[model samples]
Target: MHFDFTDLRLFVHIAEAGNLTQGAAQTFLSAPAASARIRALEAGLEAQLLYRGNKGVSLTQSGETFLRHARIILRQIDYLRDDFTGSDSDTSGHVRIFANTTAITEFMPEVLAKFLASRPGVTIDIQERLTQDIVRAIRDGTADLGIVSGDVDQTGLEAIRFSTDRLLLAVPEKHALAERKSVGFADTLAFEHIGLHDGSTLLAFLRGLMEKNGYDRALRVKLRSFEAMCRMIEAGVGIGIIPESAARRHTKTMRIALVSIDDSWALRERYVLVRSLAALPGAGRALVDELVQNAAGGRK
Candidate 1:
């Protein structure tokens, strides 16, 4: 019932680090001291906050719920500090963002650069995740904001249209599928495919599609970026699926052919999600504004 500032700070550190020893070191407390503090906190709240494991620690459902409130409390404390200090020159806070690969790769660089330039004291931590994962991170309060593909559910979150891009199948100029104007995803599965790395949202989505069709996608080659995938396809390593914007750019330079994906899901849109606009920290709300404005301008 009566946890102090130190307790909240320590809890935040531990949740972020997901390692007891490391979190303790960050707080400049020994492991034993940190563990005792956490125990006291749990006892006071009558709820277990962490699931300690061999690999690392993770939040329980209650822990996740508590973390959301903890972050809001911490942000409020920061606001109080800024108010008393009268430090208008530097408006500083941390905003954590989780976004899908498409949004990260295709949309965010310029927008983030603009936001960071305007608020020099603000810092952002960005993670690339799949759409569903982004939603979960936002829902769990692990992230301040999320940018996700619109095809995913957004039942409980406030979402705004962010951007739109489509997926295209890229193949070697001489590949059998190259002559086709468009093809189903299943039609391309027989050929060895090039793909982005395993954790990429695009790759995960494709894998899910293959799974739904009762087959495994054979990713014979995996590359780190769209350009790399294009080069692999050019060399006949394998065909690949890539964002149409990237495919159009790469096709001009490489001896590759792009065929429209004959699937409804290929044409994708991105959405920026937040638990509540009013609840977001100053910097996070600013970023949301920038993303929404940019998307609107693009539409015009």
Candidate 2:
């Protein structure tokens, strides 16, 4: 029921050498030592593996079957060993990303698609978080990279500027604020508004702005994505503030009105943050490069 790998190798050497002594020499074992091991192995299997004669030993049908299987098993073990011994440049692991809501909804999808197309072995895990939380996660090593916006303290991280993000007021085409060329964040608070789902980074940022500025608040609905928020705004659910890129993009096909925010805080530059870009693992570096390239060329 059980035989060691040594027994298999010894049996194979003996079969190729055409005798026990020569096979023992090949395996660096004495003839008597090899004979004892073979006897034990045969006993364990309860099969006569060799036909011992004056001309030397030859494989019985059982020995032939064992040799064939032994070679296959040895080859697989060698492959496993080689895989573990491969270099760190192997882009075959997981890459963790923490990003803000706009980066997750409006930015990452196309960029990630291009990155994943050629890296069949690479996988990505992304989570949406507030900018400060994303920065903290990257610093603490829980995340490999982060996409964040606005004036966050980046004292110990590597920040690579990737894109500009501007928040705009999205309203129905015939809504009260639709004809306005621009509106202040405080001005929009008087009307009912749509918002992102709870825990969204954009919603948190907007809430902070509303608290800091003198503005009444009314949130009638909360949805998951910018697309959904735009749809709600178009349906006259309420006006919502979302990324300008999303608002403009959605306007091409939806009856949504885009109103510029006069507040300077509404426009912020987004960055890719890492503890140290040069020290990233191969897969991580590749993804960072993909993001930088996509940003420079602009995403479709």
Candidate 3:
């Protein structure tokens, strides 16, 4: 009843080899040592675990019952060790990432796919939030990495430029602006525009782009999600501005036409990689490297 795992291992070894000498050879123990271990286990369990004969050894009735339990225990320990060891070198632990809807839907999937393909044992948890929420998650230690569209003001975060995505004007295929070669800031203002929420970094960037191009009025919209923006455009509710990547993905199958904006504004917005200024785990570092390399290679 008070047996340790070594006793159980001795029992299993004896069961498989059916003799002390052979079992000792398999386990790298001397024959005498292996015999002593089996004798000690039998004595502790108060069961004659083996019957010695001229040719070999066979299990007694009590040994037959104990062998079943012994094998199960050894297998369980093997599994426990394998699980712990895997978490070390194989990047088998959990990693968390935060991003807004655009980054999650359009960009993060491709990056995650590549990371997962290489580190198949690792599990990733992704959370979608607005830009401010994404930064806040990193600052609060709730997320290991953050993907956001614009600059974050948090003090202890390290940000790196990964890729550039252009912001585009999209309209329903039949809409008047759909056929235009390009739209200017003044031209956009004349339309009932679809836009992200005022708090979104996309909205902030769009506002700055408008201001830089000398548009003095507010851009109007009833929703925040690109899907919602698409729905509005499909209904001809208004023309909308969105990341070109998003437009390309969601609108390709829809009746939408994407147009470029010709303004003095920064034509491309950045997709930035952010992590705590504190040290990152090896897995996180690997992920960051993959993301930057993929970005440089122009993958999504």
Candidate 4:
């Protein structure tokens, strides 16, 4: 049986919008045209696809199953179109990347800029998420690539080294902890702390450590970005725990001191993860190759 791509696309839109009129408008089809197409599709499949209610429309059980397959088919068609028409010198496609805060703050900007500069036809959609969320998105095929903390569970994903950076105790230049070469987690409890926003991966990890060691201390302030956190530390608002890469850059002009953490968790290793390197689309594979090559060359 032949299924029209237009019908499949319309079905997906309606399923997502939950309103036939809105979906039809979004797809640029009149209400009657949209209804006829959906009915035709149902006739071809010999299954009820939608349940109409006073409020809106919803997918039937069969519709849910077909929606998943329809999305896959559309994605494959996009890949095929790009592969056949795009040239090696002008490879064109879209890559969806999900990354953690550490990777976003410490890496990715230069690498992505370089990749985009070379591939003018390629586009990237990036989302910032925690490591575990990035892993989940990769497993679900919602993202083509992921950069995540290496400590997270990556049981089914293939990962390559992306970057290496570590967390450090950041303090004001004249703070009491500034003189110490290394300090334990417990020792830092005496001072007010600057921290990332609640629910951040780093903040969660630090909280876990505090709970494990039975240390309780409230944050003096919570900020969103590493730059803001470092600035706060420089202003002596409070000491903070930040990535060494970020701290190193800020310390050039900011009056901040980076003290070593005696904890093993301070040493961070990040990796680029994907469902499978071989399964990635051509553009994604190219970008991944560039990232891996850049990282390897950096080590050398």
Task: Compare the candidates by TM-score and give the number of the best one.
Answer: 1
Candidate 4, residue 275: how far the Cα is off, in Å: 0.7
Candidate 2's residue-wise lDDT over 1-300, tens digit each?
Answer: 777778877887898678999999888899999999999988998999899999899999998777667654553453354357672353566677989888888879988888888878777879888887788777766677899888889999999987788888999999999999999888888888789998988888887887787555557989988899889888998899988888889999999988999999888988889888776666778888887788789662
Local distance difference test, each candidate: 0.82, 0.82, 0.72, 0.82
How well is each residue in 245-291 modelled by candidate 4, as lDDT tens digits?
Answer: 78888999899999999988788787889888886777888888887
Candidate 1 vs candidate 2: the TM-score winner is: 1
TM-scores for the candidates: 0.80, 0.69, 0.58, 0.75
Candidate with the larger lDDT of 2 and 3: 2
Per-residue error (Å), model 4, residue 282: 1.9
The TM-score-based order of candidates, best leading, equals 1, 4, 2, 3
| Error at 276, model 1, angstroms | 2.2
Task: Report the Cα lDDT for residue 92, model 4.
Answer: 74
Cα RMSD for candidates in order:
3.6, 18.8, 18.5, 5.4
**Model 1 score (lDDT):** 0.82
Per-residue lDDT of 172-231 in model 3, one digit per residue for the tens?
899878889888766877777778765665676567767875767566565757888888
Candidate 3 residue pairs in backbone clash = none
Residue 138, candidate 3: C-alpha displacement in angstroms: 2.5
Q: Residue 242: error of model 2 in Å?
A: 1.0
lDDT of each residue in 1-300, candidate 1, tens digit only = 788877787888899899989988888899999999999889988999999999989999989888778876776676566557764232467788988776777668878887788788898889898878788877766687888774777888888777787888999999999999999988888888778898998888888887887666467988788889999999999988898878888889999999999998988777788878776666777788888887778631
